[model samples]
Target chain A: MTHELATLEKQVADLRAKLEGIERRVPSNKLSMVVFSGDLDRALAAFIIATGAVAMGMDVVMFFTFWATPILRDPAKKVEDKDFMGKMFGTMLPKGACSVKLSKMNMGGLGTAMMKNLMKQKNVASLDQMIALAGELGVQIYVCELSMELMGFKREEMIQYPAMDFCGVAKFLEEAMDSRIQLFI
Target chain B: MSEAIHADKVMDLKGLPCPMPVVKVSKGIKEVAVGQILEAQTTDPGSLTDFPAWARTSGNEIVETIQENGIIRIFIRRKV
Candidate 1:
């Protein structure tokens, strides 16, 4: 009987410790999101999430790697430098429609053009504005060091935002693991 | 601004979205000295409900909430 009692006591202690650890690490406020994709929609979504998190009294961090880094490129352009076609269309079309073609991947070139026109009518926030607001609201923007080198982007060429930081996948993974929410946009 | 002006502090959350207005306002109000007033302006329609609910949960008093030009102007006097 004593043995059983001791085991139960140990289990209880273990559970208590686990609960305390969770309470200590989990955010006191709302969700934490890690967005993975760098499409315009993803960019906008990340901004909304980060800004929303901050507005809701939660800490927010965004690790921009891969294609997402272009959104953070200094002399920030409406479209990425890598996609020459996107830039051509971005310059030709009004801002909102610039991302429409990318969204309708199956629609062929014309479909994308139509989508852009439709999106503009919907009053969605422009890609550039979303990036700006994310910076303004103090969203932590981290550039993947490896992705930066591979993309041939110099740190000096990246957009200068107070919340911007640089790190690797491992560090981002560590931070994302502790968050209440993780998003791959 | 009405003459009541019962409290001295102010919090402006105008043009911010849900959770953000609440977040900023919550932080802003916490810093005010007890018994001081906090006035916040929020463009988000949802703050009409969210702010008061948060205020209740956080133990702050919502002295008044008025709507003008589609914006919610809330007056909170820190009770706790």
Candidate 2:
């Protein structure tokens, strides 16, 4: 009985040590953001959360889909070679992060300009600045390939930032599975 | 001012809003060596909670926090 008890104690100690090792090795600080809205406010919120998480030494991944894909578009590039419907939609959509329409009270683009000015006056980083900061901080920005296809957006039409990549839903889900913070914005 | 503690590096984030202060602090902290102090000055009201919360999660130490005339100062020590 005494020998059995000693062996059990040893086994428990070994298991505890192993668990501690695993815990130390596993990365517990991760944030995954699913950006599904193209609204200026929502995009700002998403980037804010991502930057905050990255500041806390957490790995951050932003997955852009649907209307949110426009947030990744290059402000300088105009999409010209698409089907009639695609061109119509593209022309109607906001060009990029700097031009994203507000979700409410846009007032034919005036609200967006007003909001941008307010953010600027308040010294808050603009969406473009936030995106740049995200790049600097190694925050991964992934655009959903399916969404891009549906929207008739070519990869060349998007901003060519180092942190930005094109991926499918599976990639987003894979990253999200291990993230401690998952947000849908 | 004479009673103020010394910091290895001082970051001015005045007039910045939520998340910017924290983001800038995080970036600025890297310039400080481990065990060194970083002082961040911000006008944002949110830093009251944001700074402490950030320090707690990022394995850093907040040695002191002071607010006066709507400006907030946080002294943090890098742990890792």
* Share of native interface contacts present in candidate 1: 0.17
Candidate 2 C-alpha error for residue A138, in Å: 0.9
For model 1 chain A, the run of ten residues with the poorest summed lDDT: A92-101
Off by over 4 Å in 2: A1-27
- What value does the lDDT take at residue A102 in candidate 1? 54
lDDT of 1 by residue, A79-166 (tens): 3354555445334432221332354353556665555566566544566566666677667777788766665565665665777778
- Write one digit per residue (lDDT tens) for candidate 2, span A113-147: 89889888877789889888888889998999988
Residue-level lDDT for A76 in candidate 1: 43
Q: In terms of TM-score, how similar is model 2 to the real structure?
A: 0.88
lDDT of 2 by residue, B5-68 (tens): 8899999999888888998898899999999999999998889999999999888999999988
Q: Per-model C-alpha lDDT, please?
A: 0.66, 0.88
Q: How well is candidate 1 docked (DockQ)?
A: 0.19
